[model samples]
Target: MSPVLLFAVSLDRAHLQLLRQRYYYATWKADGTRYMMLITREGCYLIDRKFTFRRVQLRFPRRGVQQGCFESHHLTLLDGEMIIDTVPETGEQKRRYLVYDLMMVNHQPKIKLPFHERWKLIDKEIIEPRTYDIKTNKYYRYDMEPFRVRKKDFWMLSAVGKVLNDFIPKLSHQADGLIFQGWDDPYIPHTHDGLLKWKYAHMNSVDFLFEIGEGNRQTMYLIDKGRNRKLEGAHVTFPDDQDPSNLSGKVIECSWNPKEQCWEFMRVRTDKPTPNGWHTYMKVMRSIEDNITQDIVLDEIAEIIRLPMYAERIKLETQALQHAARRR
Candidate 1:
């Protein structure tokens, strides 16, 4: 079977009620390249969104073990994104991998486990050991690793204000949107409504297969999950400064320009092998049409999640979810 990666659907006005339906873990959607880390007996590797794997010289230390001792973890797969952060004062850049999910550990599939449990395992098994080694100076050559590894933090929906106003402003990295992950859901492959992404109006964009027709006419096509492409009849125009020959056959990120009444190129999507599927395209369009903002979503959350009528129900549901996770 060909390996596939999961994609997040856009969160529109219709999906705002999800705030009350299920407990979600929220994180700032970092503008980074998606990749999965696979640990094997041989070494460590990073698998990109296109399923291309590249080996990196790194070792995982055994938790609670002596310094300089490393373990050959087998078939451990973790999902994350690689981000480049700039030092505000010095203008220096730092490349780091922020891990957000654990798929499999030591050949044991954790996809069946709820997100909360999976995160606990990630902390205890994957992160803590390496942290111990690094802190105790037992692990040398850490500087030789390709990038720094850190765990991505998630917050409750109520604390989203802090995420937007506090956490994001302090980070040296750029964040284009926000992510809402299902706290009780399993690791779902491919696209799932359980995972939601919200972005500002102008920041909303789609990845499409760019094409150049006769007479220098530019066109865009939508690519499906199976890597199938379909003509979408979108008028794409490139600036004179950008060579059409260079972008004709690659995936391009584009957004709708209401005033100009055409699709505008944002950038070339080198990280994405194919374009967004039909469902994703329609949802993105709807989000653009509705022009939803952070404040609107927050207002809806206050109505549905914090209303006096729903307080008891929300409490009960939270307790049940916790109990079920503990049983697992």
Candidate 2:
């Protein structure tokens, strides 16, 4: 089935050069906030971490002063990812939404617009406008942080350096991965056309339904998407604060270690009841195995910059954007 929203494709040099995109922010693992909001929306829908939507109706406050007024605005409270950010120094956790995109606006779907235009729309229409009415603000409101982008200053970043140097120190949330998007192209729903997402090759992780092994070593497995095959293997690493022995028959995360030639342990995935199906497991494995590394990525950029032949399709478009931005 087609996904209900836009999704990112795994990072690749060809796609990056095609889009002429170099800047990216850390992908905050807001799995705890497994929630998606459809704003200025009359109907209801619940969005999961996977960006799947389930329609639901939620009650809202009725207008008192306006005669025969019907409430069209509904703040559909989704029960998906609940963000829990832990403070490293104070050991306190806070919830936040570092919005990556603006998919919709006041009854206007911005998915078809180019990203640079869509980003400007988001800033002007959503973030800049604020309501002072405390009572009304709570209901017809949203909690989100501004999503920013860098220009030439960030063009030389590596996927590895992006996560470690840019994301790790500045963020309290899980710096799970990196996402590259096209600024000159329209949003392609449920596909990786103009978008590319990736995690650290070594830390490319996946969750599985864990079981105890013969020697008390833990193993995990995935039920294939079609319910046909069971894909199982390897002892996984337990979380920093959990008892590994207690995790038998539960969900846990495992990372692919290319150097050690094994699947190493990462953490216990607590967000969902079960591990991802076989299809997803294979998808993640493929991403890790077929990863386009930081060095190759940077090399691609350097090639495009040095030689005109490397990025002919979108080089002019990118240059135009920079030129316009400078003039403004």
Candidate 3:
């Protein structure tokens, strides 16, 4: 039998909600289209595409051993996130492609099942057995309330800054946002039904080389000094406000124009009232030092793990190192 290929669908939050309301079972496509899967008395049918199937095959080859277990049991109606993580030190990426919600078992849809039962099934079938070849990834079946709702909903608005600050030291990659999932809500298709994600917009700071505008241009373009004519695409500023004579030191916001396929200037963020301090420099230096330290620690752990005699000790040490890295 040909192996079944599982395709992941990526959608912004709003669109996901609409699909869940209208479809019973969604078929994720590589091209980002969601098709409803219908199981009739005769066979399995694709409602949107008008395709029929006598038997459906499922396979998970890479870190998908858990899904394979479900396939062995003839379970269906699965929903979950295709999660991937990037290692900060080596820049290696790892994926688990977790399946957290089981909507069907033996061709029966579990839509009417309460949230608690669905969560329990996930833990029993996927998480507890650890059937998947989970290297650097993990499967979670807990209530997702803390990550899906707005901070304000849980009186965490003020503490969000602190939480982010606390998370920064330990995180390998940049923190994007906080997700809040309801503890008691069953995993329904995206309907804003029981899940929410709050993302805090952050401004990225980068330095760019400046260039003078020529030939009926309105704004100056930042270019590389070495490559005389090539546009480097950066935010450029003039000393007009401060000294009007020196163009060497100024601040500006740079943005890319998708329509023009060129870099453009946004505006000086006047409301960026708090000037960056010496502490910011310290933080950057600390981050680099921490990265070096983590690399050394990982190298040590890898060496320890290679020794067959100390496998258990190596596992403990590796967990400790991971925890320490998160706290960094």
Candidate 4:
């Protein structure tokens, strides 16, 4: 079924009543607070007051609001994303969410509304004017293309990637993927057209403990384990040459292990010198990983082992050497 049709039919009478009873229009709320009302086959619904662009945390209150709306109004089908935020951040860029269109309201299909009107309601009823310094008085129109009715194509993949790349950096929080909706399509729940979300798999690098093997092994670094070993206090090394002076401090991204729950060493960054401290290393690693794009891949050997491995390996090798020395 069409997305709009699905959303409209899903709502039962009880669900609609809850939305109208609980939710106050966005304009009615205090500054810095926002509300979202979504309509689906189940009914009209409100998102948690805590929900925002930074975090989408929907909860029970929102469900109650939805039930209230369905019971009170004729609103039928309406399904779309909502966001509210106050004291937005600023610097390189400011962030804000744009509502594109409406599919249903009060059990009535509203996609037939001119695209312009749908946008107008979102601006007027939902987003507060001063919340993000958005000039709603200006013209905003829905310009995106609709989803494909047939088989997926190459263009679809490219579009998904492009959307993710464009927004992920600007968002204050983590962005996993992009959501696609047909420009002409109406909102639908549990259906193909009204919405499709695409998530991308990302790669990152970080420093981990490395330990090196000893005895009969000329050079093998491995994870550090507590032991009175021959090689103690040895600095971790990247396969590529880096300034030794900078080597003793800081961890760098090497690779991510989904199962191991640790990051492998990549290269000691000579350019970005870091100070010594586990907290500092963690902060740097997280920031760097967050900035990493899909283009970066972990392929180097040294990057595979973490920094801790180096310390553990050194301890083991040190003990092995001490044992050999005693034998002599």
lDDT of each: 0.81, 0.53, 0.35, 0.32
Q: After TM-score superposition, what is the CA distance of residue 248 in candidate 2 from its true location, in Å? A: 3.9
lDDT of 3 by residue, 54-149 (tens): 242222222245455322333344444323446778897653333444566556667667654675665554454333433323444323211110
lDDT of 1 by residue, 187-261 (tens): 889887878999876778888888786998776778566665665557866677988778988999887888887
| Candidate 4 wrongly placed segments (more than 4 Å) | 1-78, 81-101, 105-108, 111-163, 202-328
Top candidate by TM-score: 1
- Give per-residue CA lDDT, model 4, range 169-286, as digits (tens): 5544344433333333433333332233222333333333333344322121222232212223333334455443343334343544445544445554332222223432343344
Clash totals, every prediction: 0, 11, 12, 83
TM-score of 4: 0.28
Per residue, candidate 2 scores C-alpha lDDT tens digits across 109-191 of 67777766775654454333322221345544333322211111112222334544665567666655555655556766554
User: Which predicted model would earn the best lDDT?
Assistant: 1
Off by over 4 Å in 2: 1-3, 12-34, 40-46, 50-92, 131-168, 191-194, 213-219, 239-241, 277-280, 305-328
Query: What TM-score would you give candidate 2 relative to the actual structure?
Result: 0.62
Q: Which is the winner by TM-score between candidate 1 and candidate 2?
A: 1
CA RMSD for every model?
4.4, 7.2, 19.7, 25.6
